[model samples]
Target: MLTRLAISGYRSLRDVRIVLGPLNVVTGANGSGKSSLYRALKLLADIAQGRIIQSLAAEGGLQSTLWAGPESFSRAMKTGRQSVQGTVRKSPVSLKLGFGGTDYGYAIDLGLPLPDSTSKFSSDPAIKSENLWTGEMMGRSNVFATRSGPGVRIRDDSGAWRLAYEHLSTFDSMMTHCSDPHDAVELLRLREQMRDWRFYDHLRTDRDAPARKPQVGTYTPVLAGDGADFGAAVQTIREIGASDEMDEAVADAFPGARIEVTSQGGMFELEMTQHGLLRPLKASELSDGTLRYLLLVAALLSPRPPALMVLNEPETSLHPDLLAPLARLIAQAAKRSQIVVVSHAAALVSALDAEPDSRQIFLEKRLGETVVLDGVPPSWTWPTR
Candidate 1:
């Protein structure tokens, strides 16, 4: 489980770090950088898939996503006594994201490449440095794998640093290329853990949404990010003998309602039997709020849980009354997977905060930088290029 998350030089998250728990609820007003934090986590997951550079490019490259404020805010600037203005940059353009767990930690630094007349992708951000270390915090002695620009090195079993690659791609991550099971066991393990990290932002509930249509029946342990296989996932959960929990979740949220996934001719369709209704309502016939809540249920009750699961604005389209049940479902899921919920709903936030081992992080914009209002920032050290 991730115990600490650190982000710097990304949107409003200019040097932000926070300790995490099994169940973490992040709440803040609009523009408090909740979305930025979510995207940062997603970017970290993308690194393990060898798509970090592509993800950054989709967001208009690094220059557009980098922190726009000054390198640092002075006392007077923060107090509004002085106008906020840019200062001479003391370092190169860098955006870093990292997370530390009890057994391992990983960080990656991205920076703008030097001006090159021959390269049309000069505007793209390059992977500057990366580090995979042991324990809860990174230190010089604990680091096992290191990447500096085009060079990659890993500590052998004899504890000697061995050069792994002389010319690694600037846009590629060591997590993808250097995770050899024989030479870099830690790297391979950490890389796979990161690859299994799941993220669910928007689960469409529109008329044309994929969840509304029947899909081929398959054993789906994990729900699709878009909830296209909602029925298959629910059926898988039921087949795994977790039908009691699934039924309880549905009834808790919708009172007398119970969820069902019917398979006809190898096509599965989701249905919900509610009180006072002679016929069960199909996924396409359900209300927007109801279908969305069911999608969240299927996602949380996934048979194959991830190492980390992140939900962004899950309260969207959810009724106030359903927030408590959703919160309860999320709390239960946290038992199997570390969850980070980014939401603005008071009911959901309060319900999640009351869960055991739950931690609440309230963010606020201070001097145009996102700052945690809960407590002191976690100790984090970024890899230097």
Candidate 2:
């Protein structure tokens, strides 16, 4: 499980460190940077896949995503003696992100490209430094593998350093460049763990959604990001995953409700039988709330859970009454994996908080920056950029 998460110079998050628990709920008011925090975590996942650049571009590029405030507040500015202003280059502007876990830790730094009078890539931001180490916190001695610019160095089994090929690209991450079967076991293990971290934003439940239509069934333990294969995924859960939990989740959400997957040849469809309805309803006929509830149920009851699961703004179209059921489902999933929920719904947050041992991290905006008020704030030293 992740013990800590640190982010700096990303959107409204100037510099922040958050402590995490087995089940954590991140809540705050609108425009409090909860969504940006979720996106920052997603960016880390994208880095392992070598898609950070494209992900940054999709969010209006790195320059726009950088914190719009000054690099840091001066002591004079905070003492009512001076106003907030920029200094004369104490350090280069870089966006840093990292997390510390019981078994492993990682950090990455990104900065704008060097100014080149004749280069077309001068407008792009490049990944400057990345590191993977073995410990809950990153320190000099715990560093296992390090990346600077395009060069990577890893420690060999003989307690000596081994240099990778000297031609790694700045656009690509060290995970993609230096990871091999024989060298850098820590990087390889971390890459696999990063791959298993599942993120679910909003699954489509519109009139044109594919879940409303029948699709060929295949055994899928994990649901797709867009839910295009939701039918197959749920069906697989009933067949191979926890069938009892699947039944209990449905019954808990809607009393006297029973669900099944009807198969005609190779195609599969969702069938829900309610108390009053004489005939079962198809997935296309279910309400948006009901469809979304089932999607969440299928996700939570997966037979194969990931290293970590993140759900962002899950109450977008869900009714207030469904938040409790959603909370129960989430708590069930937490039994097997670490879960982080970033939401603005009081009902959901309260429901989750009511659990036996859940943690809540409330965020707030301070002087145009995001700060995690875990408790009475304390002095924190951010990673030097």
Distance (Å) between predicted and true CA of 207, model 2?
Answer: 1.0
Candidate 1 Cα outliers beyond 4 Å, as residue runs: none
Any residue pairs clashing in model 2, and if so which? Answer: none
Q: Give the worst 10-residue stretch by lDDT in candidate 1.
A: 374-383
Give the local distance difference test score of model 1. Answer: 0.92
Pick the lDDT winner: 1
For each candidate in the order shown, give its overall lDDT on alpha carbons: 0.92, 0.86
Error of 1 at 190 (Å): 0.7
Give a tens-digit lDDT track for model 2, residues 1-385.
Answer: 8878888899999887888888999999888999998999999998888888899889988889999888888878767598777767668878888888889888899988778889888757798888888867777677778888878889777767777757777788888777887888789889889888999998788998888788899998988877777889899998899998989889988999988889899898999999999999999999998998898888878789998999998888898988998999999899998999998999999999998668899999877878888574323334443
The stretch of ten residues in a row with the least summed lDDT in candidate 2 is 376-385
TM agreement with the true structure for every prediction:
0.98, 0.96
